[model samples]
Target: DEPLDDENLIDYGLDSVRMMGLAARWRKVHGDIDFVMLAKNPTIDAWWALLSRGVE
Candidate 1:
């Protein structure tokens, strides 16, 4: 699906399992991340912000 940055991921079929998998994959490289919070704010912009938080 072509998602906009502010689009709700749930509206496009992103479920708990997919979300968990995404978090787990990210965790492999980024260390501990708040998956719950990420799920709460399910948007591309929010995801990018969360994932890039501590990077230079």
Candidate 2:
């Protein structure tokens, strides 16, 4: 059951700890990534947009 692009990750069991871990790992490649960014909008489309933009 894949989650929808607009679906909130938290509703799919993505807690703070897991989100933090993801932020840490992704931040290695995407320096702009952070917990607050993800927490602000926990949706696949939003995250994809952020990650795809690439940091300056």
C-alpha local distance difference test of each model: 0.85, 0.91
Residues 1-56, model 1: lDDT tens digits: 68899999989999988899898888877787657977889999988987887789
Q: TM-scores across all candidates? A: 0.82, 0.86
Residue 22, model 1: lDDT of 92
Candidate 1 Cα outliers beyond 4 Å, as residue runs: none
lDDT of 1 at 43: 96
Clashing pairs in 1: none
Candidate number achieving the greatest lDDT relative to the actual structure: 2
Considering summed lDDT, which 10 consecutive residues are worst modelled in model 1? 29-38
lDDT per residue (tens digit) for residues 1-56 in model 2: 67899999888889999999999998998888999999999999999898888455
Clashing pairs in 2: none
